[model samples]
Target: MKIVELKNISKRFGTILANDDITLSIEQNKIHCIIGENGAGKSTLMKILFGIYKQDQGEIYIRGERVNFRNSHDAINLKIGMLHQHFMLIEDFTILENVILGAELSKGYKLDFEKSRVTITELIRKYDLDLNPDELVYKLSISEKQKVELLKLLYRNSEILILDEPTAVLTPIELKGFFKILNNFKAEGKTIILITHKLNEVKEISDKVSVLRKGKLVYETDKEKIDISELSRLIIGDIEDIPVRNKIDNGQALFKDYITVKNLSLIENGIIKLNNLNFALKKHSVFGICGVEGNGQNELIEVLIGLNKKFKGEIYPEKLVPAIVPDDRTKKGMIGEMSISENYFLREKNLRFAFKNILKNIELKFIKRFDISVPYSGCKVKYLSGGNQQKAIVAREIMLNHNILIFSHPTRGVDLRARDIIHNEIISERNKGKAIILISSDLDELLSLSDELAIIYKGTFLKVFLFSELKEKLESDRTSLLENIGELMMGVVK
Candidate 1:
């Protein structure tokens, strides 16, 4: 039976028709997956359903009855809950406090703390969730925070749940655990609406799939009838392969020993996050670090970029300037409220060229070179699309007069066109004799760009492989290589 249905839904925002004549139905107790590229109107439709945005025209039916939601509160009361891509939990509060914040039980004008705590503890044990009720939200890991959000919805007795990009930050093991929880929810007669751009995930867990393209419902099918290649075509409108860069040899090692990091160790929350990690980057060489997410990738990046100062490490070439494009752009990379031109100035250096400051001309040249796609240089970075914003950041970082570059998940959340531009930029920098450290969760990206690869797990370096030998080595020892790397990432072996 269809638990939710939308007919002739239309929404407009100024010059953009965010959603045009879209219609869809979601079955009860089934996983409905929505797949689309960025700016494809997927978020708008989901926002309307969650009552965060009102549809300019359309009719919505919930369980065979027509209904309209004025706000998120109304939707929640009607048993609908949404877990956003960015979690919304207070960092200072404990897990139980965050879960029962807005909806608290009271008795005779007094807060019933004991009753709520008992109920929350019972729910945690019932669901087999490994979480401490008294643990502060700030102390929990990303996966743990996600589980807290889920518990919030369950605590409210929500019948229908909407998860947006739920597994983007989870490790492979955590992902498996999450899928098990989702299956349990379905078995208990709860409906799920999953919004994602990952095609492999859709094929794995979805029962029904819907594809949205350019603000319209382009196609819909059951899981049995869809494949990854077909979904890619529908979403991107083409199946062109990305261009691979030709390998080039660096002559005479222009600064062979550019930067060296020795005995790097970082401690956070009374735990050793990075322990005696050591590596060297050669001039004009790409050093790739590939591992499961959250296995010290973030901490390593933080220490390198000077964000985490509480670390013991001998950083050679400390006086040499470096540019970095961080993984979480929204949090660390760009100033959202600043204009494109203003942001470009963040990395500008004063050059004594004929006693004149020529930073303005340099900024203009970069703006044009990167094809930032903004109306004008004065446009705020926050108003630009995700891809354009990313381009602006890349332009700013690469244009800086630096000898070393650090890129962390440089192509994440970027579309195909933007990704190509980024790859080309990386190659251009490499050819210019700049040492680079590339850290990413995408193994495909690591293999394509790295001259040498290293696997880091639990704040320790497991092994390093040279690209020249990878092909021959993999042919002879595929099982051992994959198993050792996998086991190290999971902390099964050192």
Candidate 2:
């Protein structure tokens, strides 16, 4: 039976029509994966179903009964729950406390802790979430925190669960475990609605797949008919081929070193955030760093940029300045309310020389060259989609003409088209003799781009792999190569 049905749903934000008469049906007890590029209206459609947005023209039927939701509370009352990309958990509270915050059971006006504990513990074990109910939220890893979020929905008896980009932060090993948990949910007869752009994931776990493009439903298929190449073609519509990274033979000897670190360490609140690490950045090469988050990547970036001078280390360059594209583009990279041109020239030292016209000209140049989609000139960066917003930041930094560049998760939330564009640009810059520092949680990205790849665990580098060596091994046995890398990231293989 169809558990949810949306008919002729349409949503508009000013001149932009976010959803154009989108009609979709989600069956019961199946994983329905919605695949689309950034700003393709996948999230919008789900939000409408979750009561976070009101569709301008649509009729929603839940379990064959037409219903109207004014807010998220209404959806929750109907046993529907949404898990956003950014988790909503109280850091100071324990897992059990966070789960039962709003919906606490009562026994004669007293909160029933023992009853809730028993139920939560059983749920964790049944689903294999492996989360401790008594553990503090701040003490949990990203994967564990996600389990807590799942526990919240299951505790509410949610039959229909909607997850948005849930696997973006998971490591390879953690991702396998997460997929297994999803299968368990399916076996328990619960429906799952997953919104993501990862084609491989859609192929792996989805029973039904839907494609949206330019705010319209383009294709729908069952598992028997799913095709990854066709899905990619539908999402981005014939973009140019992605630029390839040429093999670098003896890169360390051929290129000049731009920056070097020796005995780098950082201690915060009596806990070591960065261990003794030594590395060098060379022109015409990309040094890729991969690790689970909170494993000293942020600390390393801060120290390299002179943000934290408390670290015990010796940087070769006395005054090193590099253009950086931060991981969290909304917070660290750009101001939302500011115009694109204004954010582009934010770091300029000479106000007199950085005229408005000159800045606008540079912005226009890169926008055209990079194929950034903008509605109009002088538009605020916030109005652009995630992919366009990322392209803007990347173009701005590259236009600065710096010898060294630092990119932190440059393609974190972008579409395949934008990811390809950014990868090409990075390769183009390396070919121009510019040193690049690439930090990403994605193993495929690191393997494809890095001249020298390092795995950091607990604030220290476990091992560094050369491009030629990894390429040869990957060509021989792909599975073994990934297994070795996954073990290194988790510190399982010392």
Best model per TM-score: 2
Weakest ten-residue segment in model 2 by summed lDDT:
102-111
Give the C-alpha miss distance for residue 353 in model 1, angstroms.
Answer: 17
Q: Kindly list the per-residue Cα lDDT of model 2 for residues 1-494, writing each as its tens digit.
A: 99999999999877778889988999999999998888788777888999999999999999999999999878888889998756789999999999988766421346788998999999999999998899999878878999999999999889999998788768777889999999999999999999876899999999999999889999999998899999999988876666665644554677667889899999999999999999888888899998987798988999999899999989989587899998767768889897777886677555446677886786688777776766567778887766678888888888787889999888876788777778888888888888899998898888778888888999989988776676687789888878788888888874
How close is every model to the real structure, measured as TM-score? 0.86, 0.91
Number of backbone-clashing residue pairs for each candidate, in the order shown = 0, 0
Q: Where in model 1 is the C-alpha error above 4 Å?
A: 105-110, 239-241, 249-255, 268-270, 292-294, 339-342, 349-396, 399-401, 415-421, 466-471, 474-480
What would the per-residue lDDT of candidate 1 be over residues 1-494, giving only the tens digit for each residue?
99989898998865567789999999999999987766677767888888999999999898888989899888887788899766789999999899988866421335566887888898787776789999999878778899999999888888999998777666566777888888888887999999876678889999999998767999999989978888888887874665656657664244467778999999888887887988888888889887776668888877776777889978886655678887767778889898765676665755335211344465467666764555344566775655567777878888884778988878765555556667878877887788888987666566667777888877777777765565555668766766665666666765
**TM-score for model 2?**
0.91
**Clashing pairs in model 2?**
none
